[model samples]
Target: MKSLATLRAVSAPALAFVAGFMHAWAIASPLGGQPVWWLQLMALTLLVILLDRCRSATAAAWLGSLFATCSIGGSVWWLYISLHVYGGLSSAMAGLSVLGLSGFLAVYYALAGAVFCRLRPRGPAFRSCLFAAVWLAADLLRATLLTGFPWGVGGYAHIDGPFSALAPWVGVYGIGAAAAFVSALLAAVLVRPAQICGAWQPLLVVVLVVVALGRSHEAQDLERAPAVSVTLLQANIAQEQKFESATGVRDALEWYATQLMAASTALVVAPETAIPLLPDQLPAGYLEKLRSHFATGQRAALIGIPMGRIVEGYTNSVVGLGPGADEYRYDKHHLVPFGEFVPPLFRWFTRMIKIPLGDFESGAVGQSSFQWSGNRFAPNICYEDLFGEELAARFRDKAYAPTVLVNVSNIAWFGNTVAIDQHLQISRMRAREFERPMLRATNTGATAVIDRFGRVTDLLPRHTRGALVAQVQGSKLITAYAWWLSRLGLWPFWVLVAAVLTVAGRASRE
Candidate 1:
């Protein structure tokens, strides 16, 4: 038999690498459109098994940190495409950048793992619940603290699985909690004979949930008769050429304006930063010519344009261009850390790449909802739809809650990778949470329409330039998840996590 020290040293790193590899594949598109979800469960199960193997709190924390850093860093390896392939950065710098960011983000998981080890209970079931609670807490911190970057949450893997049914009632984080719980239970069963009784528990859940959610809710439940007619414009504008006024800018303005004139839909929306320049910087009569055409129409056109001046700074904004132009305007709220504004101390790193427009002002959280054709439309520029709570807040005032969610994104920066599909999954999750329709208009890819049940009713091909016209539904009903989370944000879920750990501790003492 192997020595105890030999097993301890060899097992942790091997487990970390295996978990990381599985986690990385869990979000890739090769396995499936939504990635392989079983891989995610497998990874989480391995992680819990490793944590349980850890003899000390310090070892557990270190193992968690190692797994997270490797897994997260590997999963977001696509950043290399953004930096080395597109941003003109060296491969070394791109790799280091992804690793640095992943390492920084892993601290939250590390802390949670440490707490779990320190407060570990006796029963495997209770311990599993405690592990899940801590994992959810870690994910919550990842999404909320420091302006939040909630990428690669395990809940995303289950978008196509039984956990999908839980979205309408619990939101993304709650699903994540459930995922972690199942993983912990499976991990215990993998090693302990005591857990054998419940070893097949997760399988039973999968069978029941798949059957329960088999109905096509998006098709039968959502209103299709009175669908809000929308025309979404995707310019296929190249990121490198977006700002060169002579070539990219001139062509984009003409193409979009012509598309706008031809469109007959009630609402027409262009992709994020489709204009590629500040309104003031555009050649005189350029905007006017388009405005003149759209100025006298029943159809309304919304264009993504950079507005404002250098003294006060610019804003990544969307404005209504056709009839009733004064009614609709949306400024992006969730600014990307390095892409939008240089993180407080990270200015030096960003100097390597030249992004056309950086450091724009953030729009207020409770910004005005655009009203058109008896439908309330809430616009989220870029990946702002990734945050479910931010969208849930609109449901607080049920009277004015957004009936439709519109996402305008220019994910060209990330290149034509799984980021497009990942973002689509994010919007789909939002639909389930709010029971509202999501219409996305993106610059490079994933231009699609998702329904109240998180189903993509229509989709445009990735990396292609064209219009995706769809009749979308508008919802007034706030899901049970939305109603509770709207008021206190993530606190209710946080409280539940704390309560679980508290109970576990009490039981351990008893």
Candidate 2:
């Protein structure tokens, strides 16, 4: 019996690590980058069971940290390519950097697990609810604090999962909270079969209700505005040479210019930094020629370029040509830490690397959407779609809410990795949350058009240089998520989690 007990103790942490890896797969399967929602629930259920079995908060915290380290570290392992291969960090340093970031993020889950173990209630229902609240609190904190990189949040998996309908009503964090609650309830029933009588009914009802609501959230529910024909340019520029004056920069300029000038659609879009040089640095007539073509024709273009001078600070911006005549500009708001902007004391880190244009000023939150062809187009630079609340802010004034969402990205830094697929799923989730179609124009991959229901209607093959032309229909109706989150931000979730924790703590005393 002592030997058996020792074996169990030895195996528990191993199980936690495996569960975390599987959870990462659920976020975006390593095989194809598609989300496996059932896998996520199963992995999370295992996590809850592991936490429940812990005798002390310290053990639970350690287990949670291990789980998160495996999950987040596995999910973003591609960062190694960018850091070592591109940024010129040594292989060891790059790997250590990735692990360090993952470990830092895992601290939040460790705290959550400790809290769950400390305040666990006697009743299975109460315990499950308590776990859900704490899990959400941790997830929210991860997404909110220290510039917030919520990459592997469980909610992204539900884009095509049973809880998809809940997106428009509760947003990603809320869906993650619901998933946590359900996972914990299942774990509770499994751990204590005697409580199945009370737990099974709610579980069954919850599943049915979510499935029903999700089924009803069809494309038909979204009020489709007039269709806009768009030409999305994908210039397969190599990251190593993207900023090089002679090679990638010149190629990007020539290719995108040709496509933009020839595109006959109502609107044309190029990926982030399709033009590697600033306006003043461009060959004299190059910028004016494209602007002249777009300036008068009915067809306008949204071209991504580096704007501003060294004195005033540079900006990662998209300039509108054609109809708006450079009047409509959208600058990137959510700057990527380390990659886009250096944090305090990180100046040394940036100096060690060889990344150009590493720092750029941030654009204002809730900037005005681009107006053209009777449709409002909102632009979000790469990874900006991860923050739904920032996007939600644009929906505050319904009359001016974006009809079409545009994402311009150059993820070549990550190479032809799963980052492309993971980013695509993020865009799809954003589309479902707001009931608006997403137009993605990227350098090298996932240049596609996604409808309001988060269905990809068009796509360009990865590593290809081409144009994906499609008729994108916009949505006019505001989802419940867009309406409230736009007005209150993530404040309601804060209140809900606090209230749940309070109730759970009170019930534990009873």
Q: Backbone clash tally for model 2?
A: 1
Error of 1 at 329 (Å): 0.7
- Computed on alpha carbons, the lDDT of every model, listed in order, comes to 0.80, 0.90
Cα deviation of 6, candidate 2, in Å? 1.5
Candidate 1 least-lDDT 10 residues: 216-225
Which candidate number has the best lDDT?
2
Clashing pairs in 1: none
Model 2 misplaced regions, further than 4 Å: 215-221, 324-326
Per-model TM-score versus the true fold: 0.92, 0.98
Model 2, 1-510: lDDT tens digits are: 999888978888999999999988988888988999988899889999999889999999999999999999988999999999999999999999999999999999999999899889877777777888998998999999999999988888888887887988898888898899899989988889899887877678778877776766554455767899999999898999999989998898888888998898999999899998888899999988987787786888888998998777999998887654347889999999988999999999999888888899999999998888889999989899999999998999989899999999999999998889889989999999999999999998889999988999999999988999999998899988899999999999999889988887776687
